[model samples]
Target: MTSNGSIATTLAPTRETLSSSQLLSSSISSLNSSSTRQASSQISKIYRQASTLFLTRRLPESLSTILPVITSPAADDTNPDASPEPAPISRASRTTRIKVWSLYLTILNAIVELDPDEGKQAFGSKEWKGLVNKVRDGDVWEEVVKNGYGGVEGDVDSDVVINLATLLLAHARTQKVNQTRLESYLAASTNPSLDVSSRLSTPTATRPHSRSLSPVKGSGTDTPRDLNARVKILELYTLHVLLRNNEWDYAREFISISSVLDEERREAFLQALQSLQEEQMESERREKEERRYQEEQLKRDVEEARRRRIESEEREKREEEARNRRSEKGSEIDYGVEDSPPRPGSSKSRSSVKGGSVKGGRSLPSSSPTARSSVPAKNVKVPPSLLTRAGNVVMNVRKLVESMAGSFKTRPMLLMQMLGFIVGILVLLSRRDVKERVKSILGKGWGKVRQTAGMGVKVSYI
Candidate 1:
């Protein structure tokens, strides 16, 4: 009975498995018919909404809105904890996928182009810097490959590749990495590896629903639109990016050997490259000339300034020397005036005069040697000449008389009294007895003065 139960249990599970497989197959068949139309419609709706947000300058919202449609459940989601991963671009219809990716790239480019403050305000500093760095460092290309192309370089759509190259060109500082990435993609697209063994072993029945839904396009250069896009990519790589990197010869070789470019297009590209090279050379020459002119002008300005400064200093020095010379000359004139001998009739000479009598008086000379020798030689100043001394005295007397006369003009009564006294004196002198008495009195006073002087002289001699 136990063996019978085991067999029944195993048999039941097998039937259930068969039934589940049949249901899965039927569901897949149904999905294949309708999934393409449904996915295209859904992608169109999502793309329109995201494009509207982007046009309205709502970048973060656009990024958020578009993310879900392009991502799928993670491969490890069986654990119920793994996060969703980005969906491969091949999962969407070709046109929708290109539109979605172009919008996404444009949004990223816009975000990178935002003013730092505005970017930081919309997305915090860390997030904004991360986005900008992703674009600038050419990491966005790798991201598109890994997330959108299932890590298949050759599988990247031409339009999407063009967009990626454009984005990197606009923001990236270096083009070497971009150049290498483009070269790899071009090589891979041109020479795709065919894994015959993998294809033979993997039966068409067990293939993923997504693969059946979106078949891979045969070649990039098949359609006219595809050819044009491929040519554009080449133009960007050769004309824009390679020129920036100065890979002139390599660009020429690439254009020459490119399978997509016709002979006419090839000639046009070469002529353009030649023109660009000439323009670059001309621009460089102009820049060098301008730089040299600026340097020379700067040097001339410095020299001019230095010369002016020196001239100013020299002028000041000359002025100072002239001022010093004038001061010295003035000082010498003052000293000369101070040290010069006094003039003949000056007040200093007048004070030096001695032993000069009044105008009508005669003074006796000193006979005693002791009197002559009494004064020290250094203390004795030479008297002015007799005539000059007399002239000065006469002038002084004349001035005094003039001053008296001027005073009399203001007081007539005082002048009259003085005249009357002089008349009285003259009338008294006219009397003989009066004249005799005046003469005797004058003689007596004169004799007494002579006697006193004689006594003094005798005493000194003794």
Candidate 2:
């Protein structure tokens, strides 16, 4: 009743492809076919001699052999005789399935060696790092395999084992191979059913031979237990495949099954594969998108930080310039008395006022007209020598600044201001009284020195 669905039949090789012939025939065919007549005969003789080494005689009466028998169906169609007994059987004489046993032993070792927390250990190494890597990359496996333990490199032996095991498991999974029910299949076939009681059973034809309705055997066809076995075998053999394969072409080899199945089963297996493929694609896409998003966000953050940093630097520069501008304006009215000389006859002693009253830390002269002769001092006035000297200094500074401007073309605004200052200095230099005041200041610089308000900053000619 159980039939293996598409998953089982889709990839498993058939009997003809896997080669159901005897070992002798298979061996001969596999050998080099370019031999001369004499060598070919010699090879044939050797094969014939070797094949006879195994003991195989006719099976006895009372026990039927599993293989097909070549006997004719009936001695006569008119009358029936008691059916001849099948081959005899010896209770103690049972043939062991040697391949299955060996397979089981291998499976046992693989399972026992497998670690949940770690992978399988390579041939000699304690660490399963080789197992973590691919099969061909395992050094221990290579050395041991070269020493003659593992199968030949580039062979499909591992793939065959796993595929076969998986097929067996698929059979156990009770997957159906066909869509039609047993009765419907029977009806469709050429075999005509007769009443059991009226007609005697024929020994040769116990079972009907109908290709259309052949019963699907779960043993080698469809069973979940078979699938479990196959999965284990696949996992185990993957190690071998990794170790031996130079190319993975063989791993991809699978059957294109022509066997028809029920619509429900076909739809189900296709759906499962579809879902698995979809999930894998989705995961990869998500990872790619996440990486791209992170990169873009990082770029945006960096750009924003740079923009902020530039703005802050500009603000700081502007503030520094403003403070410098205020300081420059303050320089117009000298804070340090020594930095700018006083007008003639206006002040003398800078500290204690020698023989004159101290006013605002300056000493006045005893001969000053403003202090004594106030009866008719209309013509009395201050000298302009000091003022003249200060005006000359300003003129010299303007020349020096214009000469400095020759070395730079930037800061045009600052250049214009310098030009304006030059004009102001020129006007001051044109006044006749200012010139006299400057001359007097140069002759009698104050009677005595006054207190120093601040350190003097000289604008030297150099």
Candidate 3:
């Protein structure tokens, strides 16, 4: 006693409350009419009843009632018109067949959750192929496609493949079926003519869902949004399946050629991909920077270690030199003892001298060479002190200046000033005659400065 049964009883009281099985039987019984129109009308009625059953969750009964009408097989397990000849079916029958195919596929998609393998088998059965082939047999196929049957039109072959692929992809994604079936669907959907070489070559801003393109004429139409919804769903499912299979290139190509996706969706997809790329680049950049920093730090550490080693060697050399000097001084002090006979009255003095020398030897500085020489030399050179080297450097500079001053032409302005200073010193040391000549030159320079100033041109003597 479902709602449909209640509704059936209310519509026709001659029938008591019908069970699901009874309702299914009643729908199928009236479909055997001789008139084509009557048969099609009965199918339409059965389609509505099946839809109701589906809503009420009586999927098994709904499928059982719908499949026979759609398949129309003479036998239970085989298609009678496996190789359908050129049979002239009426326009109404053709349309009804198309509707039945659509409903069948829809019901199959819905019931996939119940029995995925059975749904797959049903889609692959000869009954399904026979229906599709029969639809394409005559001009009726073209007319039905052009007029659009059950919301599918234009690009019918590709759309059919996409829809089947979408269904299989859903089953695989939900783990209801093996994922390998998606590969077959993907292969069927891919057409060479639709392949894209670059993503940028594809349109970014897709047309809104309100418009539809007729594949045959490339004309606009106010078609229902169902086709667009299916196309987009297929694209998304195909993309997910391709990614899950690790078909990265195929996924990119699919998105590039996807005409059903809206602009915001495309942007979101590209943005997610772009963000992934950015994350990888950022990780690489950080790794490179870390490596570089480590290298620089190692170099600095090596240099610091080298500098410390050099300083340590210099300190050891200085210590060794001090020890050698102390040892030499001690030897000199020991050798300074006189070789004279001991005086009989000064025996105490001789003994005292011997004892003082022994005490001195024992009390020698620790830096003495005889104390220790086991320390190794580091073969380091000590530079001469600046104070000790300054006189030689000064003498060399004086020689260079003297040589260059032999000719005034080789002397710069600084050398000329020095020469003038020397000349003045020489004149001061000379007699009154050289002093008078210097005084005449200074008076002439002062006279020239005064003459320039009197002429209103400013001048100064250096």
Candidate 4:
């Protein structure tokens, strides 16, 4: 029974070991609830922070510096004898002329508070009026000073876009350096190129694991700015793109004015840099040296191989052509010594002259030179050397040997002829393989011999 219980438990999955579908469903519910709660808290916090900061009219951080009161205000404007009572002013509010600077500081802080990602956490939700009120308070200060003073030129209006943008910038940087990153966030959030509403509604581009904006090395990483300088525009723009999209890793690298990507990208930049330079004549010299070496080596190799192949091919072709020429010349050695017959008319003339002549004593008249020369048909002398050669050739054919020897006691002359024929054949059979094919074709049993077939040549003609 205990063993059965163990088996049952093993077969049934534990709650912790849920299938993928169950886990996904559960995780989804948990995430939705958590995000809703966080969102609610964040909205409330930002609103409270905005309210508090905007309401507090403060001087710019730079001019918080105080100077000793050198003179009192006129006690009286109407009477020549009395100076107006000196205006009551705190040390912090003593900036009689640079009041615009103070308004700018109030606006900057209010933007900082609206941004939840920044280190400052607000206590209430989504207070856009807080930013407006801040602007209004600034205006009121300018009014008190009796001049409509300008703070940062564009800071007069309560721009919803800029407010949210500044907040976005702060949020973006909160994950990194609050002060530095906040500006980056503002840039992205405020960019007309990127629609903040769309981004908030839909899934955004994933921020990389690292969101630092450091410069790369001499390898053309992002350039460093004094922060006070006006030329870091492109770098700042790229930084904004990186942070706003939340590509933390790439952003972090761009801002770091020191990171040298010791990788292929750096190599490419180095190559590009090198291309613009022309003083490296030494490089051209080195390349020319290498080319000359290759050319010389190639020339030598070409000469060596050419020396052998060219001569060898010429020799082989010459030999092969010589053999063909010789075979053709052999065919020219014809059988007939006096090739053409005497003219028909000449033969008739000779016949007539012979008949007319005294019997066996004189010819009737000397016929045409050619007719008279057409003498009695003489026997064509089949030279014994020629017969011997034919015999030698036939003997080389393996089957012809027995034929050359003839029946042992039956034909002695035939045997003599065959031996001579075989000897003559040795002179003609140049290549060795010709000897074997000849042997195979000739060396066959008498019963299977080609004689029974009339197509076989019986008479030997040299």
Best by TM-score: 1
Q: Please identify which of the two predictions, 2 or 3, would achieve the higher TM-score against the true structure.
A: 3
Candidate 4 Cα outliers beyond 4 Å, as residue runs? 1-195, 201-265, 268-392, 395-462
Whose TM-score is higher: candidate 1's or candidate 2's? 1
Model 2 lDDT per residue over 149-176, tens place: 1122211122233433333322222212
- Best-to-worst order by TM-score is 1, 3, 2, 4
RMSD of each: 25.8, 29.3, 26.2, 32.4
Reference-based TM-score, model 2: 0.28
Alpha carbon lDDT of residue 168, candidate 1? 89
Per-prediction TM-score to the true structure, in the order listed = 0.64, 0.28, 0.30, 0.18
Candidate 1 pairs with clashing backbones = none
After superposition, the stretches of candidate 2 with alpha carbons farther than 4 Å from their true spots are 1-219, 222-262, 335-462
Kindly indicate the candidate among 3 and 4 with the higher lDDT: 3
Give the Å error, residue 129, model 3.
Answer: 21
Q: What's model 2's overall lDDT?
A: 0.37
lDDT winner between 2 and 4, please give it. Answer: 4
lDDT per residue as tens, model 3, 297-397: 99999999999999999999999999999999988876653333234445444334433322346643333333222222236688889986998899999
lDDT of 4 by residue, 1-462 (tens): 999999888867764466765988677656654654553454344334433444563312211221112113444657877423321221111122223223334454555454443322332334434433433333322322222111111111222223333333443333233223334333432332333454335331111111121121111123333221112232333344344455545544443432333345345433533442323457678899999999999999999899989999999999999999998877775533234444556654456456554556755455444434445543578658988988878767866556544564587776678788998787667667988777676676444665655445544322
Of candidate 2, the 10-residue stretch with the lowest lDDT total is 87-96
**Candidate 1 lDDT for residue 213:** 22
Output the TM-score of candidate 4. Answer: 0.18
